[model samples]
Target chain A: MSTEISIQRSVKPLGKDELAALVARDIAPGSFVNLGIGQPTLVSNYLTEEQNITLHTENGMLGMGPEAVGEQIDGDLINAGKIPVTELPGASYFHHADSFAIMRGGHLDICVLGAFQVSATGDLANWHTGAPDAIPAVGGAMDLATGAKDVFVMMTLLTRDGTSKLVEACTYPLTGVGCVTRVYTDKAVFLIGPDGVTVRETFGITLEELQQLVPVPLKATSAVGV
Target chain B: MLQFIDTVGEAVAGIRDGSTVMIGGFGNAGQPFELIDALLDSGATDLTVVNNNAGQGDQGLALLIKEGRVRKMICSFPRQSDSWHFDEKYRAGKIELELVPQGNLAERIRAAGAGIGGFFTPTGYGTMLAEGKETRFLDGKWQVFETPIHADVALIKALTADRKGNLVYRKTARNFGPIMAAAAKHTIVQVSEIVPTGALDPENIVTPGIYVNSIVRVAGTPAERAA
Candidate 1:
């Protein structure tokens, strides 16, 4: 079945920073958040000082700050992406086991990740392209996907070839099953649950256009508007 | 009692061929480069190495992998911009890879240290990584059973070590040091400073003396340079 969502309909789709700001705005104050590498890392820039969010990096740190500058950079101080980073005032360091425990033990409130594909049922596939000759590297993607209280995905709505990343079912290898709670895309925002995928909002595109791009059926919510 | 050694060569001298070695690092942060170089010099091959990554640029673990010393890599992320050596070896079928989820890798190493047999985790449930593993519905979620990863030798880097072998680390460089120190039969550490027993505060000791077997002072580490 299809439903219509009164879209924001921006002249241009929400840019990377805009999407990050949207995600940051939705995060509850005082939440513990983990931003995955790549695009998800941009979300941290939109998080305001008033938000009081504690950042967790799976490489054994909590209260992680922004990327370090020249004098602040240290080989010993880096995030999961191996980029040198600074620590917040209340930062604490632990071993790898304890760091992963923070994720796997359900201590993290929210985590934003980038995905290759997100199924209607919320299955996530981001780690491996499943290419035969490619060396597969599954970092903390699976752990963060399955372990967080709420998993939000950030990505462009379609691949470079214009194929929808939101699908009826993920064709690539699964990182975690039914783990994604919300999807923040350049074209739209989707909420995935047991009932079905819901179009929370659309950007620079109508609900009809979004449906044409996505293979899965969508139900729209008029909770948000431009 | 922790033996204080002078040379990196003597620190990693006991690692034999065909042993499972856990190298402590999350990238180059806490990697014991001197110990790895010593292992390379000692001509120990056929090693099953465990770390968060396979290797990065052409140094340390990358150098060893380039020299065909590692037979298998048990790690989470092996593909990186500078991981050409691992990529080439893996593509040529000269090396084997066991890619575990990051949290599972860390927890398994911890289980080995904590003397736990096995534990169930929901991290990789219903994913390719959990295939063929035992599954159970516990705590209202499907969890996969994972076993411990014990190491024959562990080479780690720490910021400082006391006469009693208590160790402290620098920031995120503490990644796998404390856990790897306990998970291995013999743990060798390279530290910037070797202080008197009471020099390190009791409350701040990350790894106690019991987990450390040998300690070597590496004079020119970044920690020392900064100090």
Candidate 2:
């Protein structure tokens, strides 16, 4: 298949923090959320101080907080990405199996994950690329993908080469089928549904302009403002 | 009835060729590096090793695999950027791999310890990973049956242990250690020190003494590393 065609316009990509903030605004208070490693990890940094979201790290933490700030850094306390973090009050630790049980038992209300490509029908291809040198590292993504109540993908709208990551079908090895519920990107936000991808909101572009950046069909529903 | 071995070599003496071993660690955090070093000298072959992250960056399981001792790896994530040995062996068909979803792998080990035959999970449901597995709709979602994973031996690293073999693991370093101790036929633990039986508070113990078969005091634990 031919690669995604990009018609560059005057849109300046949103900074990393903006993309994270956009995702943070949607996580309902008191939601049990698991943020995938990498870009998605930044979402925790943007949540409002009043929100009572319970962050989870599949490695073993249930109520993880932001990166610790102090000379007393306990490197042992880390998120699933193995980055040092501080635990919130009421945080509990358990066996690795129990941690996985929380993930695979459909207990997580939401999971924000980084992705290489996401299909219009909400297929996720984040785990393996099958690159000759790429290591096959399939972690808890599969469990979180299927187990979470709603899966949100936090990623850049386009790859470094200006190719749309929103595709008709994923080329990489899939993590889960029909798992993505929404996507928050540097350019725009999309809701993946049976009717295909719809523009829930855009950063600084019009509906017509946002349509030009994506390879998949963009549906503008009446619920865009909400 | 307490079993405490003095040397890493003696702790791993029971492990044989072609044995399935579950190793505890997420990356190098809780890795029994000293025991792994001792195994390099044993020269065993055709072993099936399991863990979360594939070892990388100059030590532990990565180095052991380079010595041509492991035949297969059954793990959740089997690749790190520096895991060149596994990449080369996997691409060349020299090594085999069984990539289980992380949660599934964790639960399978737990199943073995819990005396459960098998259970259904929705993790791998419509993906390529779920191919040919026995799947049925459970409460409106497709679930696949996963069997328990029992290993011949388990090599685990812990922060501290009592004379009774009660283990206490530190923070994220406690990743797979507890479950692995219960899932293996023989569980060998390497800890910073071995305290007296009553020295450790029962509330602080993560893995009970019942699951541990042997304990070895490893060098360079947190106390040593901090010093």
Candidate 3:
């Protein structure tokens, strides 16, 4: 709850591309991954060709290529975001049912999503803010949260008001119950599981500083590094 | 037998008010805009429409909602930056909404087409959406029961079709088209080109003629097609 707590040491939080590249490096090669529409989409830009990662868009395609430009912009060819996109070589298209089946059936290995809040026990709340006036539009957030083998979240550690998004329990309406496996944030990367929140790596803050920022109890992994 | 209709008006003719219609598309891709416009012209009202989003801008489904033709919208993501039509109608209590999860929506439609009664899935379990649904612990996870979504008519766009009504879609525009064609009682399609029967390769055919009711050839709309 304290916004004024500052570490004596200088620490700059990871840049947007830096955070995205960090996530890209962690994905296993040849894995099937679905990146949620917003911030998670940045991870795709950091992916290396050798990773051989196949992108899955909930709308209905596998082997999705990058955003389509100029002559390549086909209305029919698009990502889940509905922005025009291209198809990679060896790409295959299916109907909506089969596309979701790829996720719900556990064929997808990893999915990265942006979150409004993530509970210590891995509960995810990203779809709706539970506001009365806001129109509720939950696309594939629930499906991806509960369906993927591992649900990785990409979000800022704190809101602009300096409140921690990683909470003991989600204040927003949950997208999935205890479904998150890892969270990649601007401040630190956390691995959530039965034991508790583990600080895998920190960007600009120390484990001790992050512990003070987040409400949940945090433990550092033996592998923690800058 | 599939009939090649000459006009969008004739293609969408005979749709009664209060009918459940499935309009295939993910956003604007694969949406049968001409057919939707024709349906609008037919003066059908109080219809329950199903699609991914409620509507994007003041066109296609958006225009229909703007005209107050749709009574209810069954979709996953109805809120977008450009979804002002649905947002206004929803806020003003002029429209009804059934916000199903994307996966469940797709599966429910598929179940209807496949003639399945109902099935259980973990997509919405333990969430607000699963509140009243039956739940069972299956395959090491809690799953919620969901039923099929059948429709009186379906409007879909595709790239190419043969005289037999075999379909081949262009890229991601294929979303919801195949399942919707099967889930509806009558499936009306608009294609860029329609070839003679047996012109389509059987193996490459996405939706077979059996599921399709009628077809219309729409010369590529200048704005919609790739430049």
Local accuracy of candidate 1 as per-residue lDDT tens digits, B52-81 = 999888789999999999999999999999
Candidate 3 clashing pairs?
none
Q: Considering TM-score, which of the candidate structures 2 and 3 is the better prediction for this target?
A: 3
| Candidate 3 residue lDDT tens string, B13-132 | 889999999999888888888889999999999999999999888788999999999999999999999999999999999999999999999999999999999999998787889998
lDDT order, best first, reads 1, 3, 2
- For each candidate, what is the lDDT? 0.91, 0.83, 0.90
Please tell me what DockQ candidate 2 reaches. Answer: 0.50
Expressed as tens digits, the lDDT of each residue in A43-144 for candidate 3 is 898888888999999889999999999998877788998888889998999999999999999999999999999999999999998999989999999999
Q: Can you list each candidate's DockQ? A: 0.62, 0.50, 0.61
Backbone clash pairs for candidate 1 read none
Residue-level lDDT tens digits of model 1 in A1-226: 1112223545468888788878888899999999999999988987888889999999999999999998988888889999989999999999989988898889999999999999999999999989998899999999999989999999999999999999999999999999999999988889999999998887767778778889999899975443
Among incorrect, acceptable, medium and high, the docking class of model 3 is medium
TM-score of 3: 0.96
User: What lDDT score goes with residue A220 in model 2?
Assistant: 82
Worst 10 residues of 3 chain A by lDDT: A1-10
